[model samples]
Target chain A: MARVLIVEDEMLVAMLIEDVIVDLGHEVVGPAMRLETALEVVEAENVDFAILDINLAGKQSFPVADRLADLGVPFIFASGYGAAGLNERHRQAQVVQKPFAPDQIASLLERL
Target chain B: MILQNDTPNIDPFRFLGKDGEAAEIIRTYDWSSTPLGRVEEWPPCLRTSTALLLQSPVPIVMLWGEEGVMIYNDAYSVFAGSRHPALFGSNVREGWAEIVDFNDNVMKVGLAGGTLAYRDQELTLHRKGFPEQVWMDLDYSPVLDEEGKPAGVIAIVVETTERVLAERRNREEYERLQNLFSQAPTFMAMTSGPEHTFEMVNPEYQTLVGDRQVVGKTLVDAMPEIAKQGYLDLMDDVFKTGKTVRRAAERVMFARTKDAPLVERYVDFVYQPIRDERGAVVSIFTQGSDVTERVRAENHQKLLINELNHRVKNTLTSIQSIVTQTLRGVQTREEASKAITNRILALSRAHNVLTAENWDGAELRAMVVSSLEAFQVESREAIRINGPDLRVGPHAAMSIALALHELATNAAKYGALSFSDGSVDVSWQLLGDKFELDWIERDGPTVVPGDRKGFGSRLLLQVLPLELQGTATIDYRPDGVAFNFATSLEAVNDRPALEGV
Candidate 1:
């Protein structure tokens, strides 16, 4: 089973993503809800992949993405802004738009 | 003796050639009564110069010898105004006595074989009966005798009052226009030639462009950034076509201070080509206003709409989770429908409190009251709520509201509020920097810890603690149920950033 780190701000959304990750036979690392916590989790956790929300409360989650990139860990952004919100540096990274189906995450996890 | 006198009164002033009024007056004058004796006794050089002066169309007058006697032409009589006829043979100093000192200087220079000239010289003269301010151009040269010695002074007087006054009026009008240009409220600039060289910039234009020394510099050299942004091309088009170009709420990046970071701004502007008299494009006049505030306000409104859309979509996802989790816990469709309705209603009530506060935060007491209102205890005293007026952030408020709903629902079904005499006391307080709250039930049916894996139990035991960044516990006491939650005040009151994400 792959260990997937979930970084989302909204409680229900995080819980929903947590349930989806668990159903895919993956071990959960943390659903870090704040940018600072996500950054810490990226540095501390040894995970196969990560799912990131573009916004944490009112802060952005790009710092966590940067940390994860430095560690060579794969990740996907889950945001209302979708791919449009990313800076040029991370434009090529994976993205899932908000209100995504469980099968979307399932298919992406299967590829990883 | 009669034959000697019959020389036919030989015209002594025959050298005065023209038949003008001034010439006639000189011819009939009693020259024998003046310092120059008679016209026949006059020196040959004075007679010759008078002939030359009278024939010319220009206003010319000859002042003779030391007495400086006047001899003039038709043009000079017109310039003399009411001082003519009698002034024909008068002394230069006595005839223009109001300006005797000025004439004295001219006579001194001219009779000494020197020349004098004045251009638009200001003077006061009694030309038409009253002293009048006038301007004139004057030239004086000495007349020589047969021996090449100075005998008289020849003077040319040209009145220039009209020209001088017109020039003064033009100067005043120019000064007024300059004042208006400097004090104008909008940004304005004038650029000349094909190169678009900056000729003038007003205060507002200077402020708009970071107060740089832009005058005398080409538009490209003064603002390289603007040139790179393709605005110079637009100006070039204006200069070439002699047309006006206008733009509204266009984005421009500029550093308002020297060497400062580039800041984006919006502007409404026009470039109008100024033409020469021959209809050739000579320059461009630029006028504009900085509309950054208005543009930013419009952009902020769009962002808020998008954020609201995102929030609504996420809330729908949350409701989906509620439905999916609720179905997994119930046996019958009726039970599942009631559970989903109550859960969604609980979330909606929390939203009502938050929406009233514009979602910035909510009062803890308001959250508690709203959450318990769904259970309908019938009497206010059955559920006692005590807390300081503490405001929690929107996220914490939502979690606590839902959690309270679950706990109260459980109490009404089996624990405290199941019987009419049962009571529940909910109280909270701050301990140092920590936040603490309790929900204690009493005087109801015996409490039983049922399944450990229901939606309500999982949310209370797991989601509430995670959302609050705190801890929560429920003790299934035989008398009733007691629930307590604790966290740092900072965690519960995490206000969103004031600026939009």
Candidate 2:
């Protein structure tokens, strides 16, 4: 079982992603709802994998993703927006589209 | 008997006795003492009237006794003044020598015994009382003798300078209006009455309506569609309110010809109420300009912006694939970093081509050459590029560049270019709006990178579908790496590179 961090601003989408992760035999860490909070969680906790939304309420989760990368934690991005919304370096990360099926989320997590 | 200032009547002269009053007066007149000279007899009634005419207010003159000259009344003496004082009973030629020719012409008609009536015959006379020449319209009539011989001439005159000047000004005003109507560039038409029935249309108006038979027709009759679009209603409003209606950017579509496409136009127009002397609306004047091109340009710009958004998203996905695959194959950190940086540089070079072309599209040959330049340490013989000139869009160009770079790098490290006797062949062709290119490596080391699940493998298989809306296949043969891909030329050529799929 993997300990996964969820970083998303929208409460509804965050909850949906969290439900999918928990169903996938993964334990959910603090579903950090903001970029600052997500960054702090990444520094403080042990995360096996992270599922990030590119945009928080009004902030980018790029900083958290960068921190995860430094910590050697694998992550996938779930976004409604296209790849252009991400920074150049992070474009290679696995992306699961929004309103995605639970199985698609599991497969993306499996790939990571 | 006669009163001095009242009215007078008298038979004063009895030259031929009462039995022959006309003959007696003609024989007794002293013709030599006036402007007419050496006259023997006058016409019978003129002879008697000549003595009485000297007492009248209007100018009167008599030529008596065949002298063919003039006589004067009391008012005429004052008008004639000191000049030609022998005006009465004087010879026309000898007494008034300077004016004899004019007198002769008048007398000649009388001598033929014809009554000559000349009305408003302009004459300029410089008389004693008038220092400057005065204009006059003289009417001369001749009185004949019983024997049909010339006796005298009568003159009446009037002047006409002011009337002539007024007519000239009226003509000038009409010409000015005609000049304005013909030269105006805007569609202009004059309509009569509140119904705004077209009375006349300028050339521009005729061109706008695309019909020659617009005149004498109401707006509804000529172009019912215009009425349906509320143009006629607007005219009615202008007439009712006595106010002008000015509309800008008014959208309309006009049919130029029966078979032609409807031309969409935006227009600015004015409907001005023309009022009569009673301050009632008599007509409406309409003037308008077509502005279709400007509106179309604005719509095109908006479409371009939306397209750019999609292109940027697709571009990011491509970079992501490159990164993920490159990192996947690397066994060492340094090697992974180097591969990623090189791939990034390849992507950057494609972007530069897009930027230089303002994202419209990049040339296929140019993109190929740019990608191969990094790997090409030698001349053209080392790398054979064979293809017709073509262009590729940002998405396709970037993908193709990275793929080429991967192939070239592999060639340099282990295949053809790894030794001094190796070479590469690249060729492309256009199939409709899609471009197909092949990168074939030859004369290389034995082609032995056998089934290694590397970054290059994943890139060729996965990235093309997500980024280019195309397909890429890499054939691992015993001879060399043969790579092929196909994508839409339109996808690569559309402007602002962000626009296409």
Best by DockQ: 1
lDDT of each: 0.86, 0.67
Candidate 1, superposed: residue stretches over 4 Å from native: B1-5, B9-13, B18-49, B55-57, B61-135, B138-155, B161-166, B188-201, B206-288, B497-501
Q: After superposition, how far is residue B60 of candidate 1 from its true place, in Å?
A: 3.3
Docking class of 2: incorrect
| lDDT (C-alpha) at residue B251 in model 1 | 94
lDDT tens readout by residue for model 1, B176-250: 988888998888999999989999999989888886889999988899888889889999999989889999999
Candidate 2 segments whose C-alpha is farther than 4 A from its true place: A1-112, B1-33, B36-158, B292-345, B351-363, B379-381, B389-399, B409-422, B429-436, B443-459, B465-471, B478-480, B486-501
Tens digit of per-residue lDDT, candidate 2, span B1-501? 134224334343443233332233345666446544333333455655565554445655555445665555555555555654544445666655656677677677766665555443434344554443333345566665566555566554344434444555777787777778868888888888767789878888777778647788887887776788888888888889999999887897776676677766787788888999999988988888766677667767764664455445434544555555556567899988888788778878877876788766678888888999887756557788989977655546656777788788888888877868678889988888887778887866567654444666545555443344467777766667787877666544523323432
For each candidate, the DockQ is 0.35, 0.03
TM-score of each model, paired residue for residue: 0.76, 0.57
